[model samples]
Target: MPQDTIPNPILRGFNPDPSIVRVGDDYYIATSTFEWFPGVQIHQSRDLVNWRLLTRPLTRPSQLNMLGAPDGCGVWAPCLTHANDRFWLIYTDVKRYGRTTVGGASGASLRDFHNYLVTADAIEGPWSDPVHLNSSGFDPSLFHDDDGRKWLLNQLWDHRPGRNRFAGIVAQQYDPAAQALVGERRNIFPGTALGLTEAPHLYKRDGWYHLITAEGGTGFGHAVTMARSRTLEGPYEPHPDGPVLTARDRPHAALQRAGHADLVETPDGRTWMAYLCGRPLPNRGRCVLGRETAIQPMAWGEDGWLRTRDGSGDPELAPPSPGLQPAPWPAGLEWEDFDGLDLPIDFQWLRSPFPDELFSLVARPGWLRLFGRESIGSTFRQALVARRQQAFCYSARTVMDFAPAHFQQAAGLVCYYGASKFHYLFVSRDDEHGRHLRVMSALPDSPQADAFTAPIPLPDDGLVHLRVEVDYERLRFAFSLDGEAWTWLPEMFDASILSDEATAPGAPAFTGAFVGMACQDTSGTGLPADFDGFGYVERAYAAKVG
Candidate 1:
């Protein structure tokens, strides 16, 4: 990897809403994970130019149980900090959102955005189970004052009719001894005219309490808004200019949807920012890889306000290093043989924290055995294990041996986004088509479109090779009886559809695209499929593989 790529997405693929903290010479950033379980994604860095995936603290069923949690509603913005010689983490678990209902009546306007706090002695923990906080709204952060008082800040939700649902940012005192919030909650910043105020992070600098927030929603118009108050409470003045950092005016910039930022200072008294950004695909302008975490240089102005190093207010594609020794992690493998007893660290499964029910590395010795649980579109359990689509041009290949005796059972590969949006290539048996390979897609625009291509009949060997190549907006799949010869599926699917922007107007589309193995048995039988191995080669690092 070249140093020129330093500033562009220090953490790539589905890592969003970054909350960065500095403890000593080490820096850690916590990003929202949404429905992809194992909760929040945390990465550590010695130099802002290089970052390594650290640990996902929310592991066990007790800390996070997203069995039925809707898409884009699992884990929201998380704030990470170090105080009292321990790591403090605040997060929001949204059970229900948008206009859609969850296990309730259709068209119901109910929402559940529960907030919690967890403490860990080390970044990679045996972390304590989460302590429930208020559910007033989402995007919660705990600010530890210099005087030893702790205050909690979050955006209050106003679901009342004729009112802006985003309301404003609020703050309240939190008592650590009682493990609860004390004092009355007060609205600190009503936000600017940008609207949709959320994702609050507070800082105390000089003689002021500075508030940093994400406003104008999380789309292309997203921005980082800053405000400061002389006291802990009362009136806080917004920055004289508009957003401190945004790409709204520069539509052609390499990074889009840049907002939700956090700041950290080095031992040398220099400041750097960790923020979330997206790279939309050409032609379609959809960010299929989802929002990623990036770093930029920040300098304080003589006016007592923070601005980008260049003062352009736009995210830079190439940024300067944080002046620390670069301790880059060794490159990971491109092909996984599935011979190990545990799943690869780079891969994660969806919901159902208990992995025994969905997959096993020991079930079939040197294979990943997936027990068909439900349809791929089921909100509950589905036998799908995947990794993030980190690059716009990458190829994912897998070999599966499945004997689907009934039409209800299917096992193969999937390029997935959500329940209602994905492109799947699987092997199944039907009364008419017998055992065959088919390409099915659930398009975002057409909810009722559970359409499939013409089935290609196959022998009863149950051994097949599958691969999908993605080049920008085009997605093509191929298959083989032997691992040597490959045959294209003859259709160029639109890879751009698997994006947050592709979802409906007000729907929650917080997650990025994932490509991996999946199995489904709609017949109520736990049929099993064995996958020998998996390979993902991104063009950016293609030299490491082939």
Candidate 2:
């Protein structure tokens, strides 16, 4: 394998549950965002190796309202398809989920789950408002049949007591003329005997309808399995060979939790799959980067089964490069100097953002001004703008001019995994401490939540520069009154706490980590913090270890 392989993980970090579609020579993929606003991240690629962030369709609050949505409970798997001279997207907004006890009762009793459809004539456009669809379950995909009929496929979630969570796979007839689902949603395929089956994608090839699903949960036992039938709604039979792709049995493999795949055919008639997989750190097997998009070269077996390049049914670390000249890679690191009025595409807020009230660009001219709303732990309004943690080893630093009149106001750099679990380094003023900078930590189930270090007095001048270095093992916080002279904090915090495993058992931490700057005035002052710049840098390392 080449040192810098191009076939694997075309997109990295927090980009999970990829649903890929190709229009002519161009390809597009959509990934889940969870509670992050500007939901349902979409990426485009011409040569398959070089992918770029295109657009997020559910930007408007009417399309997506994630306010008060718990961690990992916003947008789930999104399916993208092009048909009828337009592109169609199907997605689910999961506001609540999870089992409560042995009886299979779930927190989803509130019925906060919803599925919607949206279309656009162009890849990037003023997309149509969401058309409501049945939300019997999540991870929905739309399929266009040869007879000019449209259908929707999704997992029928069984919330009934004494039954498994995954009931079965169901299909419903969609009437394009009426722009609604017409017929009954019938049960087509229960599953492939693999429990916890979900993430269904329907495809038709050579007179057979192919149904692919992610099974064995989304954890280590995750896998992509398939079934087929002659009719759109019929008795489906599982592939005799079982799963076509998985890392569950291969614990020593570099990539883990491989599943949730979507297939696409190239102009040359070759098939490839874009799926979600994770590369865990060496010993402890903690996936700090979370699930990412990985590609595997695939082929149609003579028997109509999809097989990997090696015929071994395992994901490849360095598969043949889909036979194309390598294009220039996009810039990886993101830096915001606050020089532009518009925020970068990489930055996002916790929910439907109140742009005018929460952030300002004209206040400081060349700075981003964040007026505090709520604390970081609050699920409601929080003046936070953050970028996804795209790598395990990275450094995020920022320069801010903030003077907190009371202990309630503070602003600085943050490493946030979820609303409840984060590390904050900020400058605050108190009656006893006068003016000082501090480091605070929050962990799930910890008695000392939001623990902070003793205030380290800051310089008389209000300007402060803060930096945090995370090497996947530990996080080190540092400060500099002058840009040149830096003072390192005495205590080092564990970086693993900012991960899905460290989140509270009941909280939805399905999303990966993020880092950025934030300000909050719990004192109800609505004080504003001005930040001159924010920069993030990461080391270049291969995500796959073959």
Candidate 3:
């Protein structure tokens, strides 16, 4: 993986709070698709060492619905940009958070999070429908000035009562011909002291207006804070050297919760940045493949600040080629015969944006039915589709057909990460194991995780193939039937409890692991499950692949 070098998450698994832009030689980035669905994950790179997956612009339901939205809560941190010629974006849905923050009784910390805004002259779209913008907080930004003026910014959530509930970063004046937000909102940047400041991102350079934030609270003491201000309204200053990037003192760094950054520039002026990393699992512990998107290289100090071009604030496993001419992109599809009718922009589903009421492809044209619904930790509806485990040793497989006549009906294969974390395996029946295949699990344990495991009959069956491998924190499960021999499942599991540090002690794991296909039928009756294709590869995370 080298052509002068460049390979630091250029965008990997669960993608997180990135937010990049370029528009001229094309470079986009966007990220953060919390509860999954069609929210935002733009991608598209020309030679920042190749990338590709150009669209997911909140594909309709009046632009994002999220049915019950909860499982890290729908889309947060979007912002993508370009200007006048159009391409703006901005996001944040998050409705309600964990339950009782610790012992409960805090103030201004219940977090509901809203915030919108859209635009598109073309990044692939007729896109242009949301423009709400402001539920008071949750990583939002706009900024577009040079006198054409436009500004917004966010992270102003201060629910009072000894305040500190991430109450910093604010701004205003954005009236793109009255699309709204005009004048006085100020409070510019009060970060530093390593508080939990949110992700702001503004930048002016020469006359200096800088800003860029994300402090110690995305887990494991994350960072990235920077500040400046020559008067875009601010008394800003911090960065006489403090977090311009951080690995929280690099605990043996391989990228871990490394802050939220965003900055571009590379016409020949060279200044990169991208941010949002995390790769943990052994020793530094738990990340399961969430928070990804890295890109390094930054340097601008003649006392103008902005470090890490090797000033070593950590996070740069290979950064060096911005010199272009290395466009590599070809490797996707080893299996997924759901035979088209749409479903394979690498898959995603959950929090229903009405995925045909949960799965369908002309009913079974090539198979991928699902139907079932409700129970896989249902925040509302649940058929679960999934995709994105992005390797650390991977393997997935599928085949299903399902015949669960009872036991309240169930379907198959899952790995998941929310609804308290997951495991699943399924087939179900039970008039005393009439059909059988079981394995349930939901881990956050004692912190609350449910369990089931103990069935295994299966013979009146013809399809059911399933498989899962995962090596990084170990996960097993396997089965076959007439597909040709395989059986594992001697119980290995704890794939790091799916992960975002073990499905968060009580919330805010911001998504990661996920293996596909699920159904369920609390017995309301729908019951169906077809599947027939879905295969994933990627196990060779450095060495082990049979």
Candidate 4:
């Protein structure tokens, strides 16, 4: 009998740069959050198909930067590992371009790149405060050798003698017990013989120490390359043919620019790879979901070299195996009804340096209250919004009722990136006007610019449903006083700015552009927005699916 088949994109939306580790029958995965708070997100899955958020790895104010928007900054690709009866996560804290500091600057100041370590006895933590590693480089990954030696693999600027280059890969011994660099760092691999490389992940299997790095930049040309060595310290040999996975040759492949992958073996002994990829709309390259997580099957070739099943190295839209049974669809927690003691695994916040007091999971009964603060630009910085971007096309509907005590208390649904790139469809009451629904937009580097406001007038019934429908490249928004009789909003904004090429650039960054629906009450009056009846439907329309 033929095995049961499931649709392509077992997990959809904005989940990208998936790092998977198996602990017994349970599987855990984490992904990149560029400028989003609660930096690294942890996910738990019984089957590889169904996943739930475990907990955020970074919770302390000292660990994150909540008040500033780190453009193409925040947490990049993170690797999760289980060792010696504990869980260890080593990740990069990317400082935005202009936000970094040269000397002793303050307030959204850019600092040197650094890798931090966090550990917990349980996946659901109480994670320890971040232990800062090297003060330079990005995309830091941790590996444990068979001899029980720990190594840190990272991509740093190649500021050698006269070569003014931006990319290089290095490895050094890491003393996890000491939480510091143990030995001299070695330049294992630089950019490709022809191009640049970043987001290097190291793994050892079958006596080969595999150095998997992303190359060709993070745009449409992104790719994954592999070099292997018998000894961890010796010269590594690049795959004879070149990149093991890429979409360069297959320019028209449905999933474009696949790279930054982590490999794992299922309990059933099947090998699978999870990476970030994006789907570009016609005539546009901006990704709404940004770079998204995708999975592909892996197999050892006749020569014992690992290769993607599709041969192009791009993320395939099909299952990893033909005979594997499809798992049931995972249920998502409703944002309005989220009254649990902890935040759901699917809900991820933006780049917040202090996530603990930035928002509360149980601050109120049946409400996730985010107190507005003036640190970040507007309330965009302090808003506690959670997003699940696992599907290409979806509809997020929410009922936001907030009585702003002050002019700064604007509350509603938002599609947020950093302080610069975000769109919001929300309702706020002015001192003069009762309540009005408005739409706002912010571009990165631009502060509170290009905001076109249209007041949504509702009936006296005191209920309005705001819905945003994403159809590939086009995003259509509608508001209804009642569930039926929807009135489409005339203003439609082009959403290609979310693409990794358009956003991060350079590295083969996980371009899983997340199209999430989040809620926030940014009015600084210390009053919270009362939101209720939040619902999201994945792939609401089959037409023009990404």
Candidate 3 lDDT, 214-292, residue by residue in tens: 9998877898888898988888988887898888967888888889889999888878989898888874388889888
**Error of model 3, residue 170, in angstroms:** 25
Per-residue accuracy of model 1 over 384-450 as CA lDDT, tens digit each: 9999999888989999999999899999999999987899999999899889999999888775666
Q: What is the TM-score of each candidate against the true structure?
A: 0.96, 0.95, 0.37, 0.84
**CA lDDT scores, all candidates in order:** 0.89, 0.82, 0.83, 0.65
The candidates, ranked best first by lDDT, are 1, 3, 2, 4
Error of 1 at 117 (Å): 0.6
Better of 1 and 2 by TM-score: 1
Query: Candidates 3 and 4: which is better by TM-score?
Result: 4
Instruction: Compose the digit string of candidate 4's lDDT tens values, residues 163-247.
Output: 4244578889988778888889888876666466777777877788888888886667778888888877658888876877777
Candidate 3 TM-score to native? 0.37
* lDDT: the better of candidates 2 and 3: 3
- Local error of candidate 1 at residue 380 (angstroms): 0.7
Off by over 4 Å in 2: 1-7, 99-111, 329-334, 445-448, 540-546
Error of 4 at 125 (Å): 3.4
- How many clashes in candidate 3? 2
Q: Candidate 1: lDDT of 481?
A: 91
